[model samples]
Target: MHVVVVTKNTPDTAATVTVKGDGTIDWGDSLVVNPWDEYAITEAVLLKEAHSGKATVLTVGTDEHQEALKHGLAIGCDQAIRVWDGALDGCDSLGYAEAVAAAIRKLGDVDLVIFGRELADIATDQHVYQVARKLGWTMLGYVAKIQALDVAARSITVNRLTEYGTQTVRSTLPAVISVVKDINEPKYPTFIGIRKAAKAEIPVWSAADLGLDAAALQPRTQQLRYQELPKREGTVEIIEGATAQEKAAKLIDRLIEEKVL
Candidate 1:
């Protein structure tokens, strides 16, 4: 089985996000793997070991994306692919899905593809579906547990967590799965693994390398503006009455008048 895990470079959740007056973000060189992708990485590593398969990390970004790729390698991925196409700038979810799907197709004979339930930066949670659509593969999303995966049989079964309840899904191999954070606990890379990953040669690719059309990579959406959230203000008031009944009556009236009842 060959497993591919998709990851993305994003600001550390702990990092302070600041928007400049000119509407540009000041990242200040702090970057890390999207927190949610950690689950996908862990799942890929576990699945690879269980099935004696190969696991690879795939990412799309600039030079700063190396950190995220290395982190995945340190965790247990066999190799990494970084797509740094200049034409991918400002690429939205659809564009990203296109590039990643193209790369996967280039890899050839892949059995499984994994992704985080959502990207932390955008939080749109659309990459998995988009990539699956592009590849014409079965996509199981919000997977909380991979109950079964049979590479030889070319089949898989998983329990997905939905808003209403958990749903069990069965699909064939060559599928795309988006795992939620509850799927598994991510393991921290050991010192030895970290050192090895740091030295690993992560090949970078461009749109041409993936046989992708630059025109198709153009983003469909545009940002209109960026505005800081307004600061919250608080005020406190105590309901007053001489007696319990009086207080109750006053509170009822106030709630009724405010339409909060």
Candidate 2:
């Protein structure tokens, strides 16, 4: 089995967010490799361990992306590929999907493509589905558990978590799966893994290498402006009464005053 895991370089959630004068986040001091992509990497490693296959991790970003890629290798991916270029700086979910699909095509003979349910920077769960559409592959989203992989039959059976409950579905090989947070716990890098990852050579790719058109794949989403969240404030008032009916009436009056009723 040849598994390809799609990872991302995201801003650290622990870092204090600073808004610039223009209202966009100041990422100069922010850390990278947010948790969501780690889940994808962890799942891929587990799959490889179960089926005895090689796992490769890929990311779309600049040379700085290597930090996160190295982290993936340290976590357990067999190899790493970095897609970087000036043209890919502000690409949105759709553009990223196109670039990733092109890279996967170049990889050849990929059995499974896995990605985190969403990216922390964008918080959009659209890339995996878009890539699946472009590649004409079956896609499963919000997968919480992978029950079995029938190698002989070339199918995968997984349980997806939804608002209603868990739904088990089976799909043929060469499919794309977007994993949720509950899928599995990501493993920390071991001493040996870190040393191996440090020595691994990460290959870099450009738009031309991936057969992508920078102009045609420009971002469709426009950032008109970014704004800081409003500060929260409230006052607590306790209503004490002898009777339950009186307390209820007072609460209704307060709601009416606040125009929430």
Best candidate according to lDDT: 1
Residues 69-114 of candidate 2 have per-residue lDDT tens digits of 8888998999999987777878887888898999999999798999
Q: Which stretches of candidate 2 lie over 4 Å from their true place?
A: 236-261
- Per TM-score, the best of the predicted structures is 1
Q: CA lDDT, every prediction?
A: 0.90, 0.87
- Across 1-261, the per-residue lDDT of candidate 1 in tens digits comes to 999999988888788888889887777677778998999999999999999999999998888888888999999999999997779998988899999999999999799999988888767787789999999999999999999998999999999999999999999989999999889999789999999999999999899999988777888888766677887776655789999999899889989997999
Listing every candidate in turn, what is its Cα RMSD in Å to the true structure after a full C-alpha superposition? 2.9, 2.7
Residue 241 of candidate 2: its Cα lDDT? 85
Question: In terms of TM-score, how similar is model 2 to the real structure?
Answer: 0.89
* Model 2: lowest-lDDT 10 consecutive positions: 25-34
Candidate 1 lDDT score at position 82: 96
- Error in Å for residue 119 of model 2: 0.9
Find the 10 residues in a row with the least total lDDT in model 1.
Answer: 230-239
